[model samples]
Every structure is written in structure tokens, then in C-alpha cells.
Target chain A: MAIRKRKSFFDIINEYFGDVEELANQFEDMFMEKPSWSQKNCTMEPLKDVTVTPKEVIVTVDLPLAKEGTIEVKPLDSKTIEISAEMKRKIRFDDFGITHHKGEFQRFYCQTRIPVPVEMDKVKFNLKKGILEVHMPRKRGERIPIE
Target chain B: MSEITIIEKRNIAPDATMLFGFPDVGLVGVIAASHLIEELNLEEVAYVDSKLLPPLIVLHEGLPHSSLRVFANNNILLAVSEIPIAADIIYPIIQALIDWGKNKKAKMMISLSGIPIQERQDAKELKVFAAGSTPEMLKLAKEKGIDILGEGYMVGPQAVMLQKCANMKIPALTLLAQCFYNYPDPEAAAEVLKSLANITGVKVDIKALLEKGEEIRLKARDVMKRTQQELSGIKKAREYDIPLYVS
Candidate 1:
């Protein structure tokens, strides 16, 4: 007869946490689901990324073919910013050899949500080598004095 | 049945330089390989069949084609993968390709790829580095004035191919150009191609490639995202770590 040892307490706790992590990942995939572009908006969504550090939040967007003078970044709210840029030339599905889909996009558009609190007034941005980098200083709460 | 098989659609010439352009940082290999195919006018001679791959078939002009294929001309047999190969299947797939290439008596195998840099966008120029499967290959790269990637953790198909080729005593090399981690970089592709030309004397004009750079980036966005996910799964960032060499 084959015998199996019972799982220890730490093993049970690890397994439970693993399940929780998996569930969290599934939920994130579900909530983050959306098409990368919108034909109605006539805007192609450029790739963007966000990173948070102790001092600041840095957001970078890959804006290929973006005209230097036509780029704009506006704070929509405390935690959200809208970015848009006009491409040097309009792009069409036909440009990509797709005849079935008929649409032309002249701009890139997207909204990024900041995860942590940041100072909106102090936002600064620069465009270089076709990448737009936005820097915002993080907000730190006041320290409490202990008697 | 073998887990991975290379199916030839037509006769493949022996003694050819086998090149690999699997998806990696900045989609370097894919971009370079596409340009090579267009410039060299290479034809598809073979495709990879594997249960290890996902149930995905890329359609071109209403025709089904394997995501992984081998394009060839008189002197070059280029292996190109349209989709990123998952981490678990990388070893087997690369080993199979090495075995196939070896059987064909390939003179040398080279993998065109990229090394990610944090400040890639701001850099005015990109540099290409090389790693070799043998000492002679390293010496050859140096003779051509290419810098050697002396020691680092390279995670992906090219890394696997290099190790496998070394074990089987086949000459192999990997060329990595400095490039963006997340964005498709056609500029890096051009730099690596220049190195390829210098090393092998196989030249292709990069003017057309440079002209269509932005369009390539826009079209390559989805593939780059998928490749990034696969790269993360393979712990690709370990390549950036400075190793403690005991020897």
C-alpha cells in the first residue's frame, strides 16, 4: 500500500497564497482587456510604460513619426494624464497591406493612470529621439512626531 | 515522433551560412531577417513543426504559413520566427535547428539579435557586440573590429543555439546591437546588419530599411509586446546582471 504524508502548515499557507496570486493575475488580465486602437477615434495607441521610484514617477511613450511641435500632454485629473501627438504622415491599414480594414490614423492618443500620488503641478516632460518622457515628483505624507 | 521537426519544402543547399533571427529585444532579429528576405529575395524552403508550439498559424494573403520558417538563397539559410517561442520549448526548438543545420554541413551559424540599454532612445549611435561558440569565432569577430560580449547571461533561442552548437563542435556566433527594451528599433537593426556585412562580406543596402523605419515600428508593436512577455518568462533581464566569476 502507498502512503502519502500530510502537507505541513507552511506548505498549506504557501499554496493558499499562490492561488491568491493566480487569481489576482487573472483579474488583472480581465480588467485590462481593451483594443489597442480605435477606428472611430482615428488614433493609433502608442506603446507606453510607467515606473515609480522613491522620488518620482516616470512615464515614457513610444511616439514614432510624431511631429516635434504637435505633441501635447495634459493632466486630466490628479492621477490621469492624456497624451496625443500628430504623426509626420497619416497611416492607413492599406499602408500595412491590409485591404479588408479601411482606416487612416493621423494621431497617437492614450491616457495613463498613475498608481501612486504625484504632484501634478510639478510635471515636466521632454521629447528626444522620438520618445516622450514625463517626470512627476511623488508626494510623501508628513512624518508624525513620537513623544 | 520527435518533439520538434524541421520540414523541408524544397531542396536546401549545403555549405550555406545559416542565420537565425528569432524575436528578441527591439525585435532586432525579426526586423533584420525581414529586410534580408526582401533584399536577398530569398524563398521559403523549410518550416518547423512542433507540438511544443502553440496552436497558431500566421496567415499571409489568405494562405496559412508556419510561424517558424527557414528562408534560403544560394549561400544563406535563414531561420526566422514570426511569433516568439515560449520559454519551455526554446531549448528543444533551437537544438533541433542546430542538428538540422549541422546535417546540411553549414559553414557557420549566426544569430542576429539585440542587447537592451536603458538610454537607447537618447543615444546618437548604437554599437553591435558579438559572442562566439568557439575561440576562433571570437578571434574572427575581433579581426573585423567588433567588440566581444565576454561574459553574460543571454536568455533565449540564440543563447540556446550557441551552447548547443558549442557542444556539437559547430562554429556559431551571436551579434547583439544596443537597442530599446520595449520598443521596436529599426536603427539597431541597421547597425547589426552593417556588422553582419563586415563580418561575412555579405552586403545588403540598408537605405530602404532606414526609409521605412517608422512604419516598421508601428507594424511591429504587437509582436514586440508578445516577445516581451516571452522574454520575461525566460528571466531575460538576467543578462544585465554582473556575474561573480569563480574562475
Candidate 2:
């Protein structure tokens, strides 16, 4: 008579890798070839746009399905302005063979540089079309300056 | 094999230089890599070959340039390269990197990446997150103000390297920026870059990153619209933990 024993995860892993290393290696190679770095698949933006006006540069960024007051902008260097926003969203996995659960996540950060340095005190921003816009005067000689 | 031509073959040198940058997750890695090659005048060391995989071109600047790759755009390298999420592929890829770094007498491995977090990115702050295998590495991460990941899974090349480095007992650290995932967020990249600059004292321009982000945002929006329509019936609306923030 033989006794049946329960198998543990460790035993299974050892048996699988020890005996089937070659098969595992081949299978692994296939996946290593796929690129997962591209932002093509995700529904988010890493940067926003701001149009430069004669008086000031109008910066715009998209933040759909988000309420106001989540984005903040600040001037860093003579030519740089920093922007950061936070939006919390819930993720549900009930549809994919997974039980219903709420998963919340926040997406944030970005920085922009003006063509020329601008006065930090003279910057203005607005959010429209799910886009945030900032207006700032162009710095003197920030444009085409005479040598 | 009949007349298989190997375009380039190279190896890591002693005290292998660790180049950190963001890849596709943001423009950081790609731009950083390109810039490092140009700034340091690094030569093409080797070209990684994997069908359907993006080119993994290694650049050597004099002697294993220990600088980060800056993108043509404003993005900086948050993580070094693309990471395959699947466990099967993840394990072996890490193994190869471990072996390569070891053979090169490398002391540690470094990677960079950015995550979309939900915070008004208007300020000069982009919450940075970090993870490492060794105690020393974690300490380094703390030294940099990068949040240490306690319990979670990162599904990219950086994640795979973390696991592999842990197994090999190699010191590794990954820096990630809180970024908006919906569009090419160069601003986020810039914030992350600032942190990297603080860590490495590397100066970079944000213009290229801004332009790249704008371009990526436009394209991604178009693709998302199409994908949403095409995948409507086939799959349920996939919700992501967007605008992610670290505690």
C-alpha cells in the first residue's frame, strides 16, 4: 500500500525548475522579447502642453475625470516652471474572474521650461477642457536678444 | 546556422558603470541613454538581439561610463530598460543581468522608472519612490528621499531586476517618479530628473522632454480612443490605478 502526500509550493517549484530548466528557459525567452516600456497602452499623459502667447506662455495639460485644485505649479529657475497634480481613482477587478474590490491609485508630476526666463510673480494658471493652462510673461532677452 | 553575422559583441568591464534612465514608461530612459552616448561620446558596445524586442543598444563612454542616459527630450532615466512582466521571462532576464554584472565585476546595478501619481504636479515636487534588494541599497534609497516599496509588485524590467538582484545578493536601486500615465508627462520626468540630478549631479535640459511628452500625449490619446472603441465589447473597460501615489 502506498500513502499519498500533499505537495507544497516549494516542492513543486524545485521539481519543475530542476527537471525542466531547458523548457523553462525557452518559454522565458519568448516573453523577454516583448517591450513593456512604451506608453502606448496606458490611458495617461506624462506631459501636458502650454501655448506661448506674446505676453505669456499658455501651458495646457489634460487631466480628465479629475476635479479642480489637484494641480499646482511653481517656478524653479529663471527658465523653469514645475507642475504637479494628484488624481485618485478606483480600480475594480470584479469582472475578470476576480472578486469585487476597490483599488485606489493616484497619478502625479511634470515640469516645464519657458523659452526664456520669466518673472515668477507674474505667472497665472487655469484648468479648462480637462487641461490645466498657465500664462507667464516672456522674460527680457528670453526671446531673440541682440548680442 | 548559415552565415549568421554577429553585428557587435561586447562585454561589461570591471566596476561596470551603472547608467540609469527611464525607457517607455516615460521619456527619461530613452533620452538619457541617447544623451549619455553623445555627451560621453560612448561607442556602441553591443546590440541586444531578441526578435520583436526593442533594441537594447549598449554604449561605452571611454570606460563603462557611470552616467545616466538622458533622452533627446526632457525626460531622464528613471529605470534603465524595459522590463518583461511575466514571471517566466522575468526570472531569466534578471539572471542574465546578474551574470553579466558579475562577470563585469560590477558592484551594483541601478535602474530608473516613473509611476503616475495623483498630486497637483504644479509644485516643484514629484513624489519619488524607490525599491532595492540589499539593506545597503535600501539605505541608499532612503538617503535619496525615495520611498521604499514594502509590499507590492512592479510589472516592468526594473521589477525583474529587483528580484534577480535580490537572488544574486547584488545591490540594486530603482527610482520612480509620480507621473500622469495618460499623456507623455515630461513635467513629471523633469521632476524625477531633478532628483536624479541631486543624486548624480547631472545637468540636463527639459525642452526635449517637454516636446516628447507632448508628442506622446497626442499619440496616446488617439490610440486610447481607438482602443477603447475596439475593445469595448471584447473586454470590459480596464481601470488602472491611475495617478498613483505612494502612501
Candidate 3:
């Protein structure tokens, strides 16, 4: 049988903060209608997905045509991962059959926000088939004693 | 004016097999339909104009065109959309397309798409599954050695197509390949197309598609992002739920 225990004060506070942070992230997503590319920076945003499990938070970014050796992932903070990669070739707007907007993108860049608290220092990642997956184990919460 | 209309530029031949490929998971349909168009040299015969759609228009060869268009040759008439079909407009758009295809005396209708699978990245081989409008169509797919999509919720344009086609008594089937839900999957697209060929005997070279997989994924990122946004509005996550049909 599974043990049942009452929530502790720290647990309640953690849950509240998590919900608030998640809501704020949703709000940020709602009001932002920015394009995926930056003409000034010549950087194209790669598509990414984040999955939060009980054990870890896994973030995967699709980086097709990205130079494997040039891929970089840095922990921006406790909750964000910034990834950058150099593309094999410069992609010009003309290459997409658009000559009007003159710009050449030489790299892929994006930031992934993790929802749950995780150990950023113990992060592990690998690139396979041009897909980069970063795995960070979740930070353990305080345990409550069961009677 | 009707809310949606298919304006025909060239006369379409009757008894053609109508196919649908709209933006959905992994962009399976769009990618497969695009490849079909290129390999078959299908020409634009009709375009769907709708007030329900956004004001955006696709620019091709410096000429503006509808985002939703129909391309055809002698035996195949394909309906493809370059943009994501919003949740609200899905019903009318699909009904209109079905009506148009029926009017054209389309022999059969098939929708190419993808079904999301967990950990698709590690899978060594992908399988294509089919859901048909009627039992006979399902049996036909079984005879052709394609797995049947017997149960599970289907989301997006392909779902609408299957439901509408079933009600209209039109022979239709949806061929879905296992694919990543949020990423552009060219391999899944190719798998779906091979099943399409088995069913329709309309085959095309997939070598070029596989070779340019990276390039296609790179170019398709923006569209996939927008499609992902639209997908959530439709409660696409519900597809993962198990249904209980107890009365």
C-alpha cells in the first residue's frame, strides 16, 4: 500500500510558486506574436518542445542542417536553456524564392523554458539525426513523514 | 456569397481519385502532397477562396494565390493547404471540399496524415495505418497489408475529412504514419506516401525527398510552429486519450 501524508508548508509554497510561474509563462506566450526569424541578428529560431516528467524535464530542439560540432547549449538560469548552432550553409531569403527581403541566416538559435525546478548543473544532452535533446533531472522536494 | 467556394481555373476531369493533405502533425500531408505534385507534375486546376480564412495569400512566382488550392492531372486531384486551418473553419472547409470532389465524380477520397507516437525518435522503422469511411474500405486496406487504425481519437483536418466522408457515403480512408507531434518529419511523410501508393498504385520516387530531409525540415520550421499553435486550440492532446463508449 502507498503511504499517505499531509502536505508540508514548504510543499504548499512550492506548488503555489510552480502554478504562478506556469501561468506567467502562458501569458507570455499569449501576448507575444513575434516572427520566428530575426533579420537583424540573421538568426532563425529552431522548433523545440519541452516535456516535464516526475523525474526530469526533457527539451528537444530540431536543428536540421545544423553543424553538429558547432552546437552549443548553455543554462541561462535555473529555468532556461539557450541553444545556438551554426547552419551548414547561409540561407538567404532569395533561397526561399523571396528576393524582396534581403537577409541571409547563418545560424539557428532558441531558448527553451523549463516548467519544473531542475538540477541545471547535472544536465545531459546528445544530438541525434539533427535533433538535440537536453535532459535535466528534477530537483527533489522536501519529504513529509507519514504516520 | 457562399462562405467558401472552389474557383476552377481549368476543367477538372471526372472519376479522379481526390486526395487531401493539410497541415497537421509533422506536416505529413503537406510534405507528401507536395512531393506528389512535383513528381506527377500536377497543375493547379482550382483554388479555394473563403472569407472565413485569414487575409493572407501565398506568393508563388511573384503572383498571389490562395493558401488552399487544388492541383490535378489526369487521374489524381489533390487538395492541399499551405497554412494551418483554424479550428473554427475546419468543418465548413472540409464539407466544401467533399462536396466539390463529389461533384467532380471522384471515385475515392484519401487523406494523408500522421499519428503521434511517443519516443518516435528512437524508432527504427515506422508503420502506416489506415482508417476508412466504410467497412469494405477498411477490409481493402487490410488486404493491401496496411494496419487498420481501429480506434483512437484523430485530430486536425484529416479527422474532419474522415467524419464528413463517412456521413456522405463517400469511400474514403485516412493513411497515417507514426510521427513526432511537434517536429517536421520527412521520413514519416515518405512512409505515408508508400502506403498511398500501395492503395492507389500511384507511385513516385522518394529518393529526392529522403535526401533533402534536412532541408525540408529547416524550411518547414516556421509553418510547423504556426501549426503547433493552432493545434493546441483544437485540443489535439485529446487524441492521446482512451475512449469509453459505455452506454
Which candidate comes out best when scored by lDDT?
Answer: 3
Residue-by-residue lDDT tens digits, candidate 3, A57-99: 9999999999889988899878788999999999999877778
Give the CA lDDT, 0 to 100, for residue A133 in model 2. 71
lDDT, candidate 2, residue B188? 62
TM-score of chain B of 2: 0.62
If both were scored by TM-score, which would come out higher, candidate 2 or candidate 3? 3
Candidate 2 chain A weakest lDDT stretch, 10 residues: A35-44
Q: Write the per-residue lDDT of candidate 1 for residues A24-84, one digit (tens) a residue.
A: 7557754675656789989988888888989999999998899989998899878788999
What lDDT score is found at residue A106 in candidate 1? Answer: 89
Task: Provide the overall lDDT of each model, using Cα atoms, as 2-decimal numbers.
Answer: 0.91, 0.52, 0.93
- Rounded to one decimal, what is candidate 2's iRMSD? 9.5
Q: Which order, best to worst by DockQ? A: 3, 1, 2
After superposing candidate 3, which stretches have Cα over 4 Å from the reference? A1-28
Q: lDDT tens string, model 2, B1-247?
A: 3111112344434554354543434343444444454454455443223333323333333243222122221222222332222333434444554564566566666665666554344445667777887888888778877677665557555666777778878877766776644344556666665665655566666566555554334334433333223323322222232335577
Consecutive 10-residue window with the lowest summed lDDT within model 2 chain B: B66-75
